[model samples]
Target: MVLKIGDARSMYRKFKPHLLMVLIQLGYTFLNFITEASFNEGLNPYVYITYRHAVSGFVMLPFAYFLERRIRPKLTWPLFVELFILSLLGVGFTLNAYFASLRYTSPTVVASMVNVISSLTFIIAIPLGMEKLDLKNPRGMAKVIGTLASLAGVTLMTLYKGKSFRSIWSAPIHMGSSSIHENWLKGSILGVASCITWSMWYVMQAYTLERYPAQLSLTTWMSLIGGAQSAVFTVCVEHKPAAWIIGFNIKLWSILYGGIVCSGLIIFIQLWCTKEKGPVFVTMFNPLSTIMVAILAYFVLGEGLYMGSILGGIIIIIGLYLVLWGKENDEEEVPMRSS
Candidate 1:
């Protein structure tokens, strides 16, 4: 009985990160839907993102200071430089592009396209020597095939917008400008760019995490630096002071949710997951968010669900499973090979 209990504990420990990531992605799905709705209400994307990072930075700073006070390593210039680059890729540019894409496309579209990050991360990892791809190995082959399948799904979703299945329920609040129509092509490109930058961020995070093991401190730094960087862009683009104002409206709600949940909470959870599992492991769960977004967007926002999206989502799921299976197999082999 003791042996069996130990085995169960071991299994749980191994799978915990994966489970946590799935839950995080689900939370992110809802967050993304709300953010898209906010964007539609005339909220300037740059201003919104700037506030998000600032809030996230402030929230994280205290926790980082308190929780990681003792164990925090000495701040070095090289680390500072890395954090700056991470801020640019992970928070500033990535989110700015992401919110801008939402202005052009639906939340579901952005979520679906973002799944390409998993594939992109996997590919980039190989070149960085962070991931090994041996064609002869079944696991490696599965990874490659899964990456291709996900990319294909992204392509289908971008190219084909079949008949719309709009929901009966209307959004409770419609506040923003409705001037922007859906430009699938431009949105898709920007979405793809966001994915790439995000993937790069993941890779860099994994690399940096090896040296700086303090997750909270790292996240705090990233948020603070990224917020400052984003502020510059916001000031340049949104010259009016009125754009930054957050009253008791959807805009306020959006910034609070984004700053607290998306940036503050989500970044910590992701950093923890990445520390436990590699960046690829964390990324592979992105497709789950796509499905979540599709459902939430359909019901809450009354967004149209197209046939192509359905089919593409299905393909992405299959690919996601393939990659996960491959990773599992690879991990199982590690102990055996070592022994």
Candidate 2:
């Protein structure tokens, strides 16, 4: 009887992290849908990002001072340097690249390319020593197969290239701005570059978590620093007084929602999930975000979902499950403790 009980305990232990991971993915899905709705409405993506970070930074400050400061890990020079780099990679460069891409490509293209992160994470994980690849194992085979399947899905979605304004997919299609077509190819390249940069950010976060281990605290500090940096950059690049001004009540509320709910809270959840279940696990679940965004965009942006997006999303979902199953198989079973 004791042995049976012990075995049951061990099984539960094995599944615990995976359970937490699913919950985190669900939370992110919710946030992604809301944020997508928010962004589709006239808000400039960079301006949106800047405000989100600023609010997140503000929200994090008191919490860090009161809760984390006393027990905060000592900051060595190397860690400080890494902290700065992380802010740059995860927040600054990634957001800039993402917005730049959005300026040129359709959201569908942007969403499809995000699938690249799973493959990118698997590749980048090797050099960082964050994850090991067992080239000979069934698990390894699954991961590779899954990654390729996802890439194929992206190709199908992008290459099919439905007409801009007259699609059967959604509502009255606005093929974005008229200027987009003039530079659509360049925008597509930039969008993919954004995906690569964002993938690197995920890997960096995983690497940093190993050293910092304090999820909320680290995100808070990074947000503070990143906010300042981005704000300054926006001032130089946009140089539009109207964009910077926080005048109307609606604008104030929007900034607060973006910053606190989307940025600060969402980031805390992301770190917790990644740390618990591993980075690839979290990345694999990101397709849920795309699905959520699709639904929200339909209602909010009146952007209809085409058969292509549906088929592509379904393919991406299949690929995600493949990768996750591969990861699960890769995990070794360990003995568990008594209650």
Candidate 3:
């Protein structure tokens, strides 16, 4: 049977959900850039972190009860366990680790490390038997190469040394007297650690979705549990009497936006998309965030969008497309096996 151009176009329209999912990731990255800038202005990092999760949890609770309480599948003990662990891992530990790292590191360092999600998810998913490894396939090769290219782009964005590139590879790199090893090294370690923990959160979230599959409701519950956990941790470790004080009007609004829109809403969207599509499908869009963040940082925060960042962002986007195209042609079904 011959297909008309109109028929082909109509068929392509079915992928709207998938396309929307990719856009949502871009949305997240853009919002996150603003959130970071807002975070930098005032308010203690840990307290803001605490408040964001707390607001997310409290805001999501009533909605979860009303919108999803009845329709959600009955929760088994095992599934409940999974949800609890997911809450602790994805929300509690991940955010806590991230905020802690942020205290120690620059956002650029954190952003660079975030690219590790693609490689980490691919590597861990194989061992967990949640994804089949077909190293021989062109699609698989593309996934690997594309991820590396994306990382290279991120490296360029974060670590490009201009014509002084060789200097970065050499020892005793001076930043106006204080060496890079002396000042910037701690931040780099924290950034890498945050990335590993963040990857763990993604893997666990994927597994949790398999069993108790109500994405929004599950996320809401996790936010509640995890928020409480993080709040307690923050209170113990970082919060002071003054830390609870709302310092500025902008900071107040920033926390609200970060909590309600960025953390709560976006996470719900992420779970929905990642569950509907494969993890790789959701993850392939990670690099596109750099483009959005770079632009936003330039205009809103008055941070210079360096030439390396712009070029690297474009390369990263290209690599992500390559990864997505590779994923589309694969027929393998890697069921979310019990982790």
Candidate 4:
């Protein structure tokens, strides 16, 4: 049976956000590996982040110029300041903090920390008056439960491996107790900082889009500003010229993938998503990355998938459903409530 074009367009409109988010998470799964490899090879996290945003800034600048020039909002001093602060919160602080944490700890630790961002964003949103919570309502309860479930699922995935699967490598994924070495505490702290800054970025991005309303232009501005801020922060602490130098290697690949796919394209998509949906809605999919990482690790790295990982992935999916369901119900009620 053939589908009508109008019907297909309707379906696309409905599922576009979900599909884009899944693609973004898949891109990030590779990012987890590439960035870690680059770090392992002694790439400075600060320098890498600076280069990434700078590359992303340039990559996006032309698109913003050609596409958004006619409709773009006037760049007032106030709006420029807002963009600068947003960039500082989004990439300038979060990326460096996250990569710095990655330097001191395993990606698993970082992933676990990231799973809590939805909850953090929800909490921040309430006080800032972006979200409403009425525990008596099932809709509110669903959001609360979903956040808890995701946190539980990620914790389970990170800490437990009930059984190992026989993969192509037939090798068991051994999560060592001592994998997180010296400065583990420091890394944990930094990871937590990244989550907080990232949540703030989401909230701020939502607010910024309301004012500016041009996703591509804002992405370009934020990228350039974030890169400049990160460069300044890096230079203040990291003065070693040798560390900043790079050639055609894994480091360059990491920067390109992160800049082009992750930041340049994905950041623009995320801003659009956050504008269409609320900040919490955009964050609700964070746990899916852990599941994707597990799948990719099994196939690409030959890491064995265990019972805990399987269970965690299932719970994460269920939790994500609850969040989305509640969000839809809330939206449906908004008009009725207002009337």
TM-score top scorer:
4
Candidate 3 residues lying further than 4 Å off, grouped into runs, are 1-14, 75-77, 161-183, 331-339
Which is better, 2 or 4, measured by lDDT?
4
Segments in model 1 whose C-alpha atoms lie over 4 Å from true places: 1-8, 161-177, 182-186
Candidates' lDDT values, in order?
Answer: 0.83, 0.68, 0.68, 0.86
Pick the winner on TM-score between candidates 3 and 4.
Answer: 4
Q: Judged by lDDT, which candidate is best?
A: 4
Please write out the lDDT profile of model 4 over residues 144-237, one tens digit for every residue.
8988888889989988999898576643433223333469889999999999999999999988888898888888888899999999999998
**Model 1 over residues 1-339: C-alpha lDDT tens digits?**
999999999999988887899889988887776777677677888888888888888988888999999988888898889889999999889988888888888776788778878878887898888777788988889888988887787677767889888877786644355667468678778888998999999999998888888888888888888889888988988878878777788888999898988888888989998877789989988888877776666776667788887887888888877888788877787789999
Backbone N/Cα/C clashes per model: 2, 1, 0, 0
Tell me the TM-score of model 2.
Answer: 0.79
TM-score of each: 0.91, 0.79, 0.82, 0.92
RMSD in angstroms, candidate 3? 6.8
Candidate 2 yields a Cα-based lDDT of 0.68
